[model samples]
Target: MSATFTEVLPARKSSKHSAIQWRPVTDDTHVAGVLTIHTDRASVAYTVSEFPTDWPGRGFLLAKETAGTDPESERYSVFCAAAGPWGDTCDCKGFTYKATCKHVDAVRALVGNAWL
Candidate 1:
């Protein structure tokens, strides 16, 4: 008789950015959703707090650039991936439109591309 033994349990999946020390935004700011996730996180408040965690364990400040007049205008909203509906998101217009932006890229580069 031929019999096949199935594994007792499936392998455990780990987050790539688990090393990142993410925090909650704790603000009323709203971010458009790009990714739809249903999985539950250990901390609902920190569900989006996944990414680079090697930063100096301190408070982070996001600077939102407002549009300028006169001749040139540079307007951009700094993305805060620390907290979001789906997590790993930015607040930039590009990210809102394409779900990706230079700010996000820069963070990925700074953190060695460890985003979930």
Candidate 2:
């Protein structure tokens, strides 16, 4: 599935927006593959098997950051998929100060509006 969201601020000179592109992963390691925030950023790989076993009505997402141009540069962060007041969480560097990461944002954007 593929989707794009653009937040354009007329007052601002810069274009503020993000895009999410995901697809079902057939590999044994992951369930879905994705990229968020900007295409230049790393892709996020998701897996249902790793979801918190005790969390009800919730699943897990593992966002992996990879540089296609540089194969060795790769990293991943864990995230929780939940409903209601509780939102997604991630261990990515941005989460330390923002409490969320691009992975969570991408998932939210995917779930907040539609499906693939």
Candidate 3:
């Protein structure tokens, strides 16, 4: 049940990073997936937006990095659960803050590795 959702993939990204599986939480508004990103440097925090009440739809700007960087920046993107395909439009504050965010990047890497 929960264990399956929390399963982590093998390490990637220069042998310093790995993406753990997503954990599902039930909400009256939207279902959510929380993924943990592990790096040799530090632990990364991530969040996903509310999944729609309907099926077969994409969740966009739902993913975000909650912490694990200087001043605790944020990042956002999209992920496919049982809904449909995986896609993302990064809205991380880093662009405006003039910094790089690994949250969206991590999600992109995980999905690219077929972890979705």
Candidate 4:
């Protein structure tokens, strides 16, 4: 599936002759379900939310770029898992896990056009 951008802005030039670059600080795997990015004048903090049935929530500050343009622009995109696992638990009595599973993956592919 194509990536979606929530915000877009023009790039800013730092020095009159120097070029600015827009770099992505997060990867698809890191921000699969991230809901927000908090930023200070110098840096940004990524806020990731977990499925209620999974592990604890997670957050991180981006230290480098993963992808994007040069001469940093204000435009930004958010990536979402197009598909995920779901359905009744498996019959295996010894297994116990929550959150989207392989079943959800199949459903997501049929519905969202891609898997997360």
Candidate 5:
């Protein structure tokens, strides 16, 4: 006996914009892999991976006052610090005043490969 799976593709025309669809080619075989999709808003979607389940979604904000090489660059410094303890809530020192500060937005922009 084998297992099978199917994934529907999104409706985008551009090769860069088109969604990916995955399915098992065999009836008696099992396949496991990871799928990641990036969009205009820097959206990240992952499948069958420890990276997704372990870390999940997170945002970062760069410290404007601090001076250095700007580890995350200027565009993605929106979320330089953890919102809360382990990012549970947006209560970090960087977000004391504003709820959705520039740092948070920058963090959202730097998800996935951008972090690496």
Candidate 6:
């Protein structure tokens, strides 16, 4: 099935917000997070990292699945880079400190590179 992603922001911002919820739809579904996906019968919504909305109930997001031998499994390797239509992100200290990281560089090289 094809999936489309979307981003949503709160009507307003506030603190003390600590809930997430999922309500069933007749023929539609949406997942809200740091990114989102939409489908005929199921959809996912991702929040903006810059200014996140308050989750209405409780939920957990599984962004990736990796083997124990993978670098993702290393404590110091908490981040891997991503790039493309939805945008780009990396979670390493370099990314956090400098807003750039080798992981992103590697991804760009592997993909033949592009300017944003």
Q: Per-residue lDDT tens digits of candidate 1, residues 65-108?
A: 22212114133333344443224455545467766544444334
Q: How well does model 6 score by local distance difference test?
A: 0.29
Pairing residues by index, what is the TM-score of model 1? 0.28
lDDT of 5 by residue, 17-51 (tens): 42322222232222122223333334332222112
Quality of model 5 by C-alpha lDDT: 0.30
Q: What is the lDDT of residue 4 in candidate 6?
A: 33
Candidate 2, lDDT over the whole model: 0.45
- Clash count of each predicted structure: 4, 0, 1, 14, 15, 19
lDDT per model, in order? 0.31, 0.45, 0.48, 0.26, 0.30, 0.29
Give lDDT tens digits, candidate 6, residues 1-116.
34332222222122122121222222433322232222222233322112122432112222322222224422222222233412434555555775553333323332332211
Can you tell me which runs of candidate 1 are displaced by over 4 Å? 1-87, 113-116
**Residue 91 in candidate 2, Cα distance off native in Å:** 0.7
Candidate 6 segments exceeding 4 Å error: 1-87, 113-116
The candidate scoring highest on TM-score is 2
Pick out the ten consecutive residues of candidate 1 with the lowest summed lDDT: 31-40
lDDT of 4 by residue, 24-84 (tens): 3255545443222211223222233222233222112222233222225332222223232
Instruction: State TM-scores per candidate.
Output: 0.28, 0.52, 0.48, 0.18, 0.24, 0.26
| Evaluation by lDDT, superior candidate among 4 and 5 | 5
lDDT agreement of model 1 with the native:
0.31
lDDT of model 2, residue 105: 60
Higher-scoring candidate on TM-score, 3 or 4: 3
Better of 1 and 2 by lDDT: 2
Q: Number of clashing pairs, model 1?
A: 4
